[model samples]
Target: MTSQDRKDGIPAGGAGGEGARVPVTDGLRFAFGTLTVLPVRVTRWDRAAARAGMLCAPAAGLVVGLASAALGGLLLLAGATPLLAAVATVAVPAVLTRGLHLDGLADTADGLGSGRPAEEALRIMKRSDIGPFGVITLLLTLLAQVAAVSGLYGESWARGAVAVAVAAVAARLALTLTCRTGVPPARPDGLGAAVAGTVPVRSAVLAAVLVTALCAAAGGLFGISGSVRHTLAVLAALGAAQLLLRHCVRRFGGVTGDVFGALAETAATVALVVLSLG
Candidate 1:
């Protein structure tokens, strides 16, 4: 839809047959998209309006993160194997974010994984097919996550699930931060654009901090004690993720959906590893 139409409160999903079809504002679209994907309606898309859609980014991240955990749980329960579990998580998202992370992975791969100049690598990323760099990046990240979870599950399955859940939450929280916190646009459109359309940085910062607090508490499960220490670890993880993301964004000239995915995945993996070691 046109930006003007979006501004005019044209519903992304237009009028319905049965009842009053309140025009879905671009403001609320991501939140609506998020809620619609969940198993429960505990939080409705309409609720996001109060927060000016900043919550939507984190909320959407939460859903995907949780979905990853649940999917991971099912895989572990069924003895489905770690690699298989990873595959399931990717496959399960019916509305698959149009290869959101895959695109980032590809672009980043083109830029970093490939030995070519940055401009040429980025051009290669824009291609639909995968390159050797893209393939390797995807494989390595997937393997890293699967291996990390498998190792955690070996130690404590509950902790592993918690790791997955918290990571999911954290990753999503990352999105809110990126969208709201003065993230310059990388592309004119795509995930970054939509995020720009929604969350404001101030609200994102608060929400991200709150999420970090919760995650730090989750960190305690790794044998780290005291809420204060745990919170510090969580903040540390987030701080590290921020520094890492900043570098990646600067390197790429902007973060894409894949970088968003990669950042979340990397942070989650790091958190779980640190917890396990703790």
Candidate 2:
């Protein structure tokens, strides 16, 4: 290991470094530091830390979700219209992540819509300027998210809050799955390469199960039907994300940070849509 790696508490030889166990706190820092605009400082950069951070991603999502829900709920309690509450709910995640995922979604849309070779498409994605495809995708995605959240809020404040939280957690769960072993990075460097295939498949699966169960429990605040609805929402969201991941992998030769962002936004949107349905 380099002196820098040692200073960062990373094990030698990258992820294969045996006998190195990262503390939960370091993992949490990694997750929050990279995934959101939170003030946490990440002290590690090795694959071991990445694996642990991905495993803890859902927990970070939970915190973001709760913060989003809180703002929306407070607005409702203050007699704000459901539309406004829904807008706040949709905006909170974007604000927290510094719009990183939305930007990714746009870039990925541009890349996919270019109809060019993988190399050219990736080049398109790297451009700072948003293309027509990216603009349209962003417009449609934000509209759908706001509309779905509004519909849920119309039903009841509690339902809206629960749905928001569940969607956030589901979004991060998708990220965890995307990093599972066998998934390759599209590029030789960048955030995607650092985290790609770092997580064990079994660990990813366990994280998904736990996140889904917790979502179900949150929905159980209403009734058995509520629990079932939330459970299905999580499953459906993950399925949608998985399809996107597969398509991106084929089109780009593997995943990138932009692809990860696209996957997250897709999952969150799908989860909210599913929850809004009867």
Candidate 3:
């Protein structure tokens, strides 16, 4: 390991930087290239660059949420059923991200449900095919998301759109927490290793606070009924993300690329569900 690797627990062998510096343009490029199917040219692949990219991930989510809200709102305006509108909204990010997060969620569920040693479970996760556990988890999670968002849209389009945006932003914010310092990568190479332990605890906390405040502010902007309840729903989603983080830490011994995806999907789903119920 290089000195930088030892210092940050990140894999080495990329463009050298005496100290990590993330230009806004490079960060945006990396975030878009990694998180979405958008055609963004990424010129950097080093540890420092990857860390910078992860820090800007939420910006990608903001774009995704805006698109999702637009689609749902359009569908509603066309007199589509609430269920159909919800499905469209849910599918928007899936398509934009190439269902990467869902794949992560499935792999994670399959791995953790295997009841095997960590090494064996990791092997299971690395496989290309999905398993029964993954199938069941994906089915249930998708159903819950569809049902909840559908109900919310059935009530009001503005409220549903705002919730979608908030959930997307919150989901990406969860990544900052997941990558905080001391979190080990699942492997010595790959996406997880490049980003693991990159985020400082201070940065993670600040991101969390900022995301919460933004989501809460969204409730009022959208004229959601029971604005307090909407804010609480965002908190609930964050709480769920925290629980998943703890579970991954315990089950896998640390965070992985799949874990990050799983957290994003789970947090987004929980946020939508809570908002729908409210």
| lDDT by residue (tens digit), candidate 3, 157-201 | 887888888889888878767778888887776567877887777
Candidate with maximal lDDT: 2
Q: Model 1, 50-94: lDDT tens per residue?
A: 234446545565566567668767877888776566556544432
| Each prediction's whole-model lDDT (CA) | 0.54, 0.88, 0.81
What would the TM-scores of all predictions be? 0.69, 0.93, 0.91
The candidate 2 region of ten consecutive residues with least summed lDDT is 1-10
Going through the candidates in the order shown, the clash numbers are 4, 0, 0
Model 1, residue pairs in steric clash: 61-172, 65-168, 180-200, 180-201
- TM-score computed on alpha carbons, candidate 3: 0.91
After superposition, the stretches of candidate 2 with alpha carbons farther than 4 Å from their true spots are 1-19
Model 1 whole-model lDDT (C-alpha atoms) = 0.54
lDDT of 1 at 181: 42
The order by descending lDDT is 2, 3, 1
